[model samples]
Target: MPDSVLYSAELPAFDRATGQLSLAAHHLISAPLSFLDLSPPGSTLLFDQPPAHPYQQPVLVDDQPRRKRRRTALPSADASPADFAALRDKRDRQTTTDRESDEHHAGIALDLRAALEAVQQGWAGRARDEGWVGARDDARVQWRLREAQDERPELDLVGLAAAQERQTVETPVRLEPPRAHLSAAQLFNRLVLNDSSSSSTTVDVGIETSRVEPAPPALAALLFPPRSGFLMSDLSTWSAPSSGIAALGHAKGGWDVVVIDPPWPNASASRSSSYETFDAYDLWNLDLPALLGDKPALVAVWLTNRVKFRRLVKDKLFASWRIKGTAEWWWVKVAADTGEPVWPLDATHRRCYEGLLVGHYIPPGTKNVALPTIPQGKVFLSTPVGHSRKPVILDLLRPYLPSPERAPNVLELFARMTLAGPRAPSIDPLPPPEEGKAGTPPRCGFYLAVGNEAVKFNVLEREGGAVRGWIRQSGLEKAEAAACVPEGQDVERM
Candidate 1:
């Protein structure tokens, strides 16, 4: 319903240089950087000591003992009763040690669970009382919504019915083609005459095409023009219908970071028909380890507030991918117009905050070298936009990446189009700008593969890109200003 309210005046400022929106009021964006200021915490006491071995101990023998033991061990016919007693004692000690170790580990696991619960509770309490939720005024948001509605009448049931009727009545019938079509000469002559007669019409068409032009360099550079280009395919058939994994493997240095925003199935999302949702179990089929490549990589996932979903992602999903979770970040959504939460903090149907779980991928048989610990429970505040559309967090994530300067080879899975920016312009390719060009924007080069075309459309529109051969139905005017980039940089579709 937030989409129905237009508050263009309060929209966040878009940074052309970064190809990202500036919503810097949130403190979480810079919190991770503070980790550099502190030393790494020592290993936990519970995990520092090794667990007792559950098998028999081996005895070493000296030269004299080896000869004596070999000679004495053969004479078992006259063995003493003390020999059997010694064996029984050893077995009993091993059993007792194993039981004690098991109890110790169980206690440690319980302690960790308690600690996690406490943290979650503390966060919930703070969120409930946060000013963005409880104290901020919504007068400005309401006023803007009212003004928008006044300028454009809100649709009611009657209007909806009338619109449906018009659509049904306006449906065009398919006319059968003539058995014999016009000859090529006749067709060519007619086209030439039409072109000559309407010079003004030709110019108007050209202008319209330019306005809704195919992908522009600026849009392509931001969303799809990474050295390793994007591959678009259905995730359900990621393994069969497409070479999603093969593409990643062929990418430059593989994917250094992968971000996934799954279309989680829920009653509300199902009713809205916004997108096709996948069962949590279905995600297990993805070959995440292969996509992560050989080196250590960062993986971030967007999760709903549901406890079961969160548990599944942290436990099963990450485990399958051979990734260990490092941090949990909260994305707190406020109103775009009033900078207040879209809903009350304690709203039963929807919480104003969603979660992002970040983890590191370490390949099997590799040394588990310690990386800088990620700060947990950080909050990123931003105004809500389209359904499930999250603000860009690449800037915030850059610090955590292995290489910030070279720009980590990034990949987005289960990607939505809105994340890709605007449609790219299909025009002549230009050369890379000189190092010191005044007002030249930086490149946000990243690869993306999406299943849904609708998602793709939304991203292009936001980035000021247009789809070729697609006619504009909405009254919204196309953007005239162009963002140019070097040409011949195209996405590799699978």
Candidate 2:
């Protein structure tokens, strides 16, 4: 979180003219990290090392023709050569292939090749010249090996009673959410208001909202560990008859922008076991449309490159949700050290990049409206952060907000960390509707929202030894003042 270095060094620089933002993923993730020591004693800090290759496409051992083996790991005792032949027959008759999915997804990348190329050569070039880092520290491996020694081995037999006591759990950082029976809505409100709640801890961005009065100093951006976001929250409460979601529809107003990163089921993500995945059908329970009421919205969703997800969003999800497809943005991941794509752009299987599908949500019966166009094929290039983590995107999305003059209500569903900056103002005692002030609750409902997975990543730091949303002492406020304040102005001149 070298906030001072973020904009000044020009790595995370955004050329307002060209609509590109480039910076190392760690710079964004490091914003709140004041001081942290996660490695076991005598271990090297993993953050100092370069990020390794994102993923290497596995070589298919079965691709080459193989001779029959005397004893193969058979599926069952009754397995026979006929069953093997049947499998080959089924494969021969299958019309669909993973290659087809690759081609369809590659089509998307090909369409945006020029745009992404331009950004890479231009803005990313400028960032590299200005010294933006390509990668940063990650200690996942070191942490895993060291943490194991801290455990009491089951091998301690009765005869081994003379053995030394097990290692004390000195670093008690938790990698999982604490069990709590608190209401998700209440927990969210406590976070927004910076109030203490059952979550026990809060991660606040010490920045002022777009408030009319002199703003309070931004709160300490600490740690958040609640598990209410989409990953593992008991979702029944979100849609129950007596739940706050019903109130969200009427009491709260509509959001300006909604960003959702649903934990869609995937073979890779499932195998990684990073967090819980949800069935596609579970999304309906979120009542996402209800959060929008009548407001026109800029919807940004993070999607995997799989064709199933792309089709789900384009063919079925959008139609049922009344969200009109508008544009697509690709978050191209490159290496921090070499500043190149982690995997080849032409590589088909195990592709390195992810998609951020941008769309518009307008309630039924709304007409004669004007909305800002989302730049098609926008490219956001940064090194990959941890699993399922994305760079901070509030600034890039600012242009398309329903109310672009200032901040608008934004909801980040399935958010890993509470976004690390100024949020839309929340006035508990709303201004009278007749007054027509900005704080007046909208007729629709809560415009912007985030899921309960807020603290999921807080635990990631504990388990993997990689910090998320922590920053260096160069505070964002300092960055803003240095960038905006006059060079010769005295402290009180303004």
Candidate 3:
């Protein structure tokens, strides 16, 4: 029997109620930290049965006492000091020799080179049986490296410094706040119009709205506060809006969870340029705790297999944010056809798995209540979708949420897609009340805000007792057109 255990199983079922997936069902192989002999001791030897023999004669022997050995006396007081020193030196040398000998025998070294070669041979044989293509060099190493760097422009430090200086000088001035007692609609109008003279203008919100660029669809609610719904956006360039802060403050107990997939920088990532990369310092400086609200919530961060990055997250990032890391789950990428690891388990360049680090946010003086423990080392098996596109693990995370009753105020930072789909629609105006009956305002739905200003807004709105969606021109063009419309005209509906 083999000493290590290799587990292979089916993927877990998804939980629709909580929108979480289980990590326990995936195939995972674990070995002992140190090698162990699984067989019974002395079982390797064969013993022949003794030939059937008869009786033996007994003989009487006389009992005699053996002489006792006498103990040596201690060195005499008159003995020379040099003699004592020599004796001590000899003993020390003997002890050192014994230690070295013990170390040599105690160290158990196993040569897995033969085993690895056998595995490779078996893999090759299996590939042949399965009619799969054998491994081959896809590209020349030298050419590949050169081609990756072809588009990278040479840096100019002097020009960059001058540009920074110019930006600092040209930064927009802060706007004053609107007057007190303004209604929500009035406040929204002032913020959207960039009313600089209003007495209630917040510097952060003002700067956010001053630019003609349209914010992400997810950030629409944050820029223009909504009663309720979901929101998703990328934090590549923009800071957290004031309305988002206020909304979180007013939430039942704040957001129930916040999942962040930071664009962690790496050499391979720089070559691909799939998304913008952020330095460790930039990720560390993000205000994650403020997004969680007043109540305790679960924080999950997706991580790569880099030891240094993992250390930064555990020792520095989470520590600074007052979040105690609880468990780590593995996302094992398997071959789509074979349902096996994409690469060998011990591949030198890449591992077959990535890690998800889960932590809990505990404020000071709060009761340190024990949360539902999630099993660590469980495998989340899934086939690769696209470059760095992770499958939604919200189903697996729902069980550990702070509140499981209602949909937890979930937020995904650095999000490229929402649970619904990519590119959420823009803000829709509530329909007018019906005749002879009080028309309650339509329940707000999920919101997704993007960072790019060029994408058109397909805002989902309520109209004529049904939900209707319309695609409007980008906010930059729409705002310009709105300025020329008659004061009483509804330019948004038009």
- Point to the candidate with the largest TM-score: 2
Backbone clashes in candidate 1 total 15
RMSD of model 2 against the true structure: 15.0
* 1 or 3, greater by lDDT: 1
Kindly list the per-residue Cα lDDT of model 3 for residues 1-494, writing each as its tens digit.
Answer: 11122333433434444577764433322111001121111111111111111111123346554443222223569989986887677557755445443342232111112222233343444544431111112110001121233343212212222333221111212222321122112212011212211011111111133354664222211111121122222342223444253243333335556677776787767997655566766775576666554577788889866666666786788887778746666666555234355654444345656778887887666686766665444454544434565555655565676654334445556554322211111145547768886543221112222221101111212123121112212222112101111112233532
Q: Which runs of model 2 end up more than 4 angstroms from their true locations?
A: 1-100, 123-232, 239-241, 245-253, 420-452, 458-494
- TM-score-wise, the better of 2 and 3 is 2
- Give residue 444's lDDT in candidate 1 (0 to 100): 27
TM per candidate comes to 0.47, 0.56, 0.44
Q: In candidate 2, what are the lDDT values of residues 309-379, reduced to their tens digit? A: 67787677777777774666776666554556677676644666677888788788988677776655565
Off by over 4 Å in 1: 1-229, 239-244, 368-370, 418-444, 453-455, 458-494
**Best candidate, lDDT-wise?**
2
Local distance difference test, candidate 2: 0.46
